[model samples]
Target: MVTLELKGLHRVRSKGRVYWYAWRGGPRVLGEPGTPEFVASYNQAIDSVTTPDNSRFRSLVALYKASPDYKKLAHSTRRNWGPWLDRIADHFGELRIAQFDRPERIRPIIRQWRAKYAEKPRTADYGMQVLSRVLSYAVDPLGKIASNPCEGIKQIYNHSDNDRSEIIWTDGDIAHLKKTCSVEIAHAIDLAAHTGLRAGDLLRLSWSHVGEDAIVIPTGKSGRRREAIIPLYQELRDVLARIPKRSPVILTHSKKGPWAPGSLTKAFDTAKEEAWSKGDNLHFHDLRGTAATKFYLAGLTAREIAEIMAWEENTVERIIRRYVGRGAAIKEKIRRLNEVRSRT
Candidate 1:
């Protein structure tokens, strides 16, 4: 008989035959000793065993962080996830993955986090989403848990409740913003209003992206490598012509080469405060919605707007419905009817 000394391997005799068990609990059978099959099974079992410390939530998050799926996220998305993941690890690091097999155990923790940021429900919801994704990863390829605990829980944040009607910017508001802000800030507001580019895309825009008639973006928030083309309107072109390109990026600070995201936000907030002192609820992002409304009024189809803005058609339609309303469509129909009557 060959004496085999493997940590998880056990020798058992049954029905006048000798068998090797991979683990004592599950008792998965390895092949007979000294056989090629037995060696391969033993090696696989050894590799599959998870140490006590490796089964914790912290360990699972570390595994997810190293995964290709996580690495493939956009730079902004990865940066956003960092703090949320850190908070999740701080709350649930010591807990073993198997402990989250029951949904009841995880619900209270999620609710508590949601309550902590009640005023910012969207942000709270985002944290829950990140945790749910991590748990999903644990259930699948990792096999750490049997199922996702966050599967059936309803999202606590109400999109309609938090939706601010005041985000829509008017022509007067845009003119006021231009007057109050510096030349660089004014150009950013105009570009966002004209092109519907997100603040991140605007900050990352380089002179190399500009073409004779269009600005080509190699990548945006979407994970895919598809390029988005935004035509350069005459107004936007004139703004670009006025500004001298001192650095590689089109948007820059007076002294700093490129505007950092936080700095740009702070500057916009100051300008917004100065522009609209009373009942000012506008945000820098609202300018993108303003541009979407303009596109609809200019007779551009939702599909065309979606391609230029790098948004889904459904999203563009929703923005138009929210901002333009049915009144705009009715007014256009009335004007066309009057024009036809005059022609006849």
Candidate 2:
């Protein structure tokens, strides 16, 4: 049996009532009568209110803002997650969280979204992740719904072993782009391909980071300082040498500051469009993939690739094995070249 009192109830100062019931928990209101079943229902409603709903989406946003870790997430990650939450809220409309405990209710909504918008598996997977995070904090303390409803729901992602659509600029492609692309975009592309720096890292690079024989990245994605030695590639050297050193930033449009992330992406987009005709869609990150793949094909070990590219060792191994191949053909070519010339 259980009982609840209502202290804030209308027309009463303080009153209490007892009723038959089970376990007891939740906010106490003196002078109100609540049976165990009623109390459980009320607590469930309150839990629903705390989770992502039409009204509670604002609260959830407030909670995220109030968290000290809000500033710790990467700027790009925060930006991506922000709009994703808005989309999820829009999909749910005014549905309460408790109402979503059943998969049937959620499954229709997901199917509807899939039907309306032909979202690829990768995009759908990202949406699922964002939804899961929103409800992660709303789990019941009694271990009834110990985790969010979205917990452990596997996302179906597309994988391919023979996807040769990667934008690996051949020697000819680079030559054509250099001859045609603008000076600024060309320099950015050169930095991306040769140094294996992310677009963000390149934009944030400073003259102080560039030394005589190498480009030093003071802060990589892993928050480690790494120095990538400049290769003997003449075109790469020419690109860096041509850029006038005016500001502290190595790749800056104005002396005030480096290009914003959006601005850089926009510039790269324009240059990429000009560099490739139709049927070739490439993104800036593909440059890193190309460089890493080339290095693996050149017989560099995963550890060596990690040091050069400032990536974790596992990442280097994964990228090489996934994108670049086993390198057996390249190795065979090297072996054949090392052999003595055949006599007539």
Candidate 3:
């Protein structure tokens, strides 16, 4: 493609390739200048920036986007909220904010919109969360409403409330999975069970993160505020030694690269379906509780494990109380009885 001069048309050369933009720091424009496509691109860019407000809701949304509060958000947060924000805009952009001035009216409307995503509880919950936040912004700094209708609405997703008895991925479970699942899935389970890292964080893990004494990396969750310093426990180290250094990431799929989010879920689900259409089960996240159990059995205190896993101290305590002591409790009673008999 050849370049031509046009007002506000920015030309950028990257990696020996030419790219055109409607303006500096603007959307990419395809086709050559003076062509119909280029002209349409420029018009679209201008229209996007100057689009008229459909309603006060949309106007407040625009204001929220430009606010310092939004600017201060973490990159991961903005990325997660991006789609939900767009969905909210598409669905409610034209609705008058003043029309539903009371909680009774707004709450029902919010629930109705949220119900559409009920099949995916987490996704639906996130959409409601983003929508609520935008409306909350309207109530506070914008003062467009007297109260936030989003407050006190219960979230539908509740993974935290899952029963702990059947949650841990034990040694037997791991061995069984290894026999049937792909190599990457096996390693992923091992990594999660040992380190208690979330799936996204573990997929992004590389050999470089393996420090001289520990695997040192910032967690993807916690807004990346917390660092996970997993010690090179012999078991974890052994798991690492088994994998060939085909790529920087310790776990990789068929292509020998990091797994994309969608691909990781697909691969995990396929592995599960191969092993577990007929019996009791484990999800990838259950490995976090498994790791916590290992840490407890290995003598780490609840507070210490909590810090390492980025969980609340009480949450760690709850998991340990539920999963770590039942058999041991009975065994200790037997030992006490045997000691009394020997003494007598």
Clashes of each: 0, 11, 0
- Residues 1-344 of candidate 1 have per-residue lDDT tens digits of 77776666766779997767786763455677777887888777666654325868888888889998788888778989989888888888888777888778877776776688778767877988999889999989888888988888777788687575336667898887788788888878877887777888888888899999898885558764556688887877887887778899988887848998778878888878887777377888888778776776676787887787777666766766665536555665686798899999
Candidate 2, which ten residues in sequence have the lowest lDDT sum? 6-15
Regions more than 4 Å wrong, model 2: 1-70, 87-122, 134-166, 211-214, 218-239, 253-260, 275-279, 297-299, 322-344
Question: How well is each residue in 93-131 modelled by candidate 3, as lDDT tens digits?
Answer: 777889546888778888999999999998898898888
For candidate 3, report its TM-score. Answer: 0.65
RMSD of 3: 11.1
User: TM-score of predicted model 2?
Assistant: 0.60
lDDT of 2 by residue, 137-247 (tens): 445322223456665565566455325434465556667767767777777777777767788888887777766766666444543435554343565577678778877
TM-score versus the correct structure, for each prediction: 0.70, 0.60, 0.65
**Which residue pairs in candidate 3 collide?**
none
Name the Cα RMSD for model 1.
Answer: 8.2
lDDT of 3 at 172: 90
- For candidate 1, the per-residue lDDT at 89 reads 85
Best by TM-score: 1
lDDT of 3: 0.79
**lDDT of model 2 at position 121:** 73
Which pairs clash (backbone N, Cα, C closer than 3 Å) in model 1? none
